[model samples]
Target: MQNAGDWTRRLREIGIYAVIGAFLTIISPYNGSGNLPLWGAYLYWTGLVLTGSLSAEATRTLMERTGRKFGVPVMLALMSVTSALAVTAMIILLEALTSGRSIPPGYLPRLFGLVWVIAAAVTAVGIMIERTVLAPVTEPVKGASPEETFLSRLPVKYRTAELYAVSAEDHYLRIHTSHGEELILMRLADAMRELAGADGLQVHRSWWVAKSAVRDTRKQGSKLSLVLPSGKEAPVSRTFQAEVKAAGLSA
Candidate 1:
């Protein structure tokens, strides 16, 4: 369900970019001095914008996975550099393929600097639009508790999800929600603390299981596993056996 919402939102963003690209195509910026026809210029700019948007999204996702949180200045610097390189490469390829003309290597440095300025300007416009126009209206209620607000740290898809469990995976947490599962860069101890509002317990050093999601308990060989409503099993460590048993999962 949430996955479908994510896809829908992504498609909408792409559509919005396409519309902007079409308008930029009509304006034909930087094309007046070029030899390409109006239609050719439209195609080139539209493709460039689409590709640039994809590259930006990819960069953001990579940063999230690697837990790279940059300040505004650093973020802007990175975006400017990345956009310039990506957009310049795209334009070079398009020009080479369509007009059989390649930009001289010697001119690339100057071209990159110019494109970086334009990319930075465009990024500013994007930020303004996001803050003033595209921002969602679902703000937190006036009296919402901090515990309830804890979900805000989760990805948009899981923000309102019923959390089932959070398992530690190195520095990342494998979050299990009623709808699905997702990985986030967070510590298990920290996640457990934030999840204090939920009726759950730590069954092992690496695993936290929601009490409501526990369907049963079963012994497999020398290990004990807590069965979830989804039929998935969460292992219980020997150190937590007594506590887990006391929680009424002896079956």
Candidate 2:
């Protein structure tokens, strides 16, 4: 499934570059040499796209190690540098392979132009690559858990999601899912670390819920209850009210 997605994204990206390259061809003083060289350039662009998809996993690993979120901007910057370096290596290798020619040493003008053009093409590809590979995981979040945010372990399947909320029998968390809630021997903070790509917020000391599951927000005196979309009311303390509001959790 991922391979198909990657290929589909790559094809779309190639079409975009093809259109741009066509415009450049029209603008440049073209005499001959059909699409051979252009196709070669296209191949190089594909390499950058693959680099981006490959980087997505590595960047997720980086986030795990640093305990930080791998946002879009950071991912783009990393891929830009990576693609640029890869293009440079390709150019050097190509030059070495064709080194038997007696070409003039003072080809500075064309060399500089070629370098920038290739770099620009690779950078364009890098951006697209980052988008496809990182979109699902790096998407903006409505809220973050206080103990440990879901952004820590990204691009990985959470063994159990339906049970993201609910408390264990005692001193532990119970993740309630369609498959049924599971008793996890951990703290609210510790257990919150296992959740991502779900809705809900930590209203009180022990509750985390899916925002979509929230049916209504009701207040009585100074307290609140997050009425789950399922009709279950989870208490919301004053201390966590600000967070609840920030999640845009409707009342």
- Number of the predicted model whose lDDT against the real structure is largest: 1
- Runs in model 1 lying further than 4 Å from the true structure: 1-8, 32-37, 130-154, 157-251
Lowest summed lDDT window (length 10), candidate 1: 130-139
Q: Taking the tens digit of each residue's C-alpha lDDT, what string does model 1 give over 49-124?
A: 7666566656656665664445445555666667768988987887787679988999889878876776776665
Q: Candidate 2 clash total?
A: 12
lDDT of 2 by residue, 133-210 (tens): 433332233564421243322223343233334543455455544333333335667545555334555667778776
Highest-scoring model, TM-score: 1
The runs of at least 3 residues in candidate 2 whose Cα sits more than 4 Å from the true structure, single-residue gaps closed, are: 1-66, 100-154, 158-251
TM-score of structure candidate 2: 0.37
Per-candidate alpha-carbon RMSD to the true structure: 10.8, 13.2
Give residue 178's error in model 1 in angstroms. 20
Count clashing residue pairs in model 1: 0
For each candidate, give its TM-score against the true structure: 0.52, 0.37
- Residue 111 in candidate 1, Cα distance off native in Å: 1.5
